[model samples]
Target: MAKMTLESLRKLRVEQKEAIERRDTGDKSIHIIVGMGTCGIAAGAKEALNVFLGEAYTRKMTNVVVKQTGCMGLCHAEPTVEVKMDGMPDTLYGKVDADVAKKIVEQHLLGGKLVNEHVFDYPARDIHKE
Candidate 1:
C-alpha cells in the first residue's frame, strides 16, 4: 500500500459526504428500510439491501431512500423489508429474497402496487400496550 496523503484523505471524505447528500437530498417520498439485525443478516437481508440499492441506482432514482435499520420485531420473518410510500400505508414484506426486493422496487416503488402474499401484518404497539 502507498503512504496516505492528507489531501487524498480529505478528498475521500468529500466524496463520502457527497454520496450521503445524494441519498438524503431528495423528495424522500419513498423509503425502503431493510432490517439488518443479526437474524435479518443471517437470513439474507444484506443481499436484499444490495439488490434494492442496485435497482434504485440503475433507474437513476433520487427520490427513493434505501436504508438499513435494526430488528422490526418479527424474528420469524428475518429478512423483512418495510416500504413507506408517499400516500400508501407503510408495508412490511417478510422472507424477502433478492427477487422479492426487485419486485418491491418495480411494483411498489415504480408501479405503485404492493407485492402480495409476502406482506406482513405486524402488530403496532408493544406487548405492554396490548
Candidate 2:
C-alpha cells in the first residue's frame, strides 16, 4: 500500500459517508421489511432481499428503506415482506420470490398501488364504534 495523503483521506471519507447515507433510514418514509428467520431463509428470503435492495438502488428511490427482521410468525407464508408507506395501509406480502420482490418495488412502491395477490395481511378497519 502507498502512503496516505490528506487529500486522498478526505475523498475517502466523503465516499464512505455517501455509502452510509444510502442505508440510513432517518429521512426515509417508506420501509420494506424482509423476514430473515430460518424458515424465511429456507424459502429464499435472501434472494428476495437482494432484489428489493437492488431495485431500490437501480430506481433511485431515495425515500425508501429496505431492512430485515426475524420471523413474523407467518411460517406458512415464509419469505414474507412487509411494506409501510405514508398514505397507504401497512401491508404484508407472503411467498416473496425475486419476481414478487420486483413487483412490489415497481407496482407498490413506484406506482403507489398495492400488489393485491401476494398481500398476506393489511390493517383491518374498525366496523363499529360505541
Candidate 3:
C-alpha cells in the first residue's frame, strides 16, 4: 500500500466531515425518508432516492434533509416515501416513481402541499417487538 501524504490526509478529513453532514436528522425544518429495502429497490426506489438527492442538490435546498430507511413494511406499496416538515403532519406516499418523487419535492417540499393521490393509510406495525 502507498504511504499517506499530508495533503491526502487533509483531503480525507474534509470528505469525512462532509459525509457526516449529509446524515439527515429530524431537527431539520424539512426532511425526507426514502425506503431502500429489498422490495423497494426491486420496484425502482433507488432511482427515486437518487432523484431526491439530485433535485435537492440541483436546487441548493439546504434546509431539507434527505435520508434512507429500510422496509416501511408496505411491500405491496413498494417505493414508499415519507416527508416530514415542521408544523405539518408526517405524510407517507406509496408507489412512488421518479416522476412522483420530483412532484413531491416541488409540490410538497417547495409548495407545502401534500400529494393526496399518492398518499395512503398503512397500518402501523410493531416490527421492533418482533
List the candidate 2 regions with Cα displacement exceeding 4 Å. Answer: 1-28, 122-130
For model 2, the run of ten residues with the poorest summed lDDT: 121-130
**What's the CA error at residue 14 for candidate 1, in Å?**
11
- Which residue pairs in candidate 2 have backbone atoms (N, alpha carbon, C) closer than 3 angstroms, thus clashing? none
lDDT of each: 0.84, 0.84, 0.84
Q: What TM-score does candidate 3 reach?
A: 0.75
At residue 12, give the lDDT of candidate 3: 80
TM-scores of the candidates are: 0.75, 0.74, 0.75
Candidate 1 regions exceeding 4 Å error are 1-28, 127-130
Query: Residue 113's C-alpha lDDT in candidate 2?
Result: 96
Ranking by TM-score: 1, 3, 2
Candidate 2: residue 10 lDDT (0-100): 100
What is the C-alpha lDDT profile of model 3 across 27-105, one tens digit per residue?
5567898888999999999889899999987776757678998888888887998898876688889999999999999
lDDT of 2 by residue, 46-76 (tens): 9999998888877657677789988787778
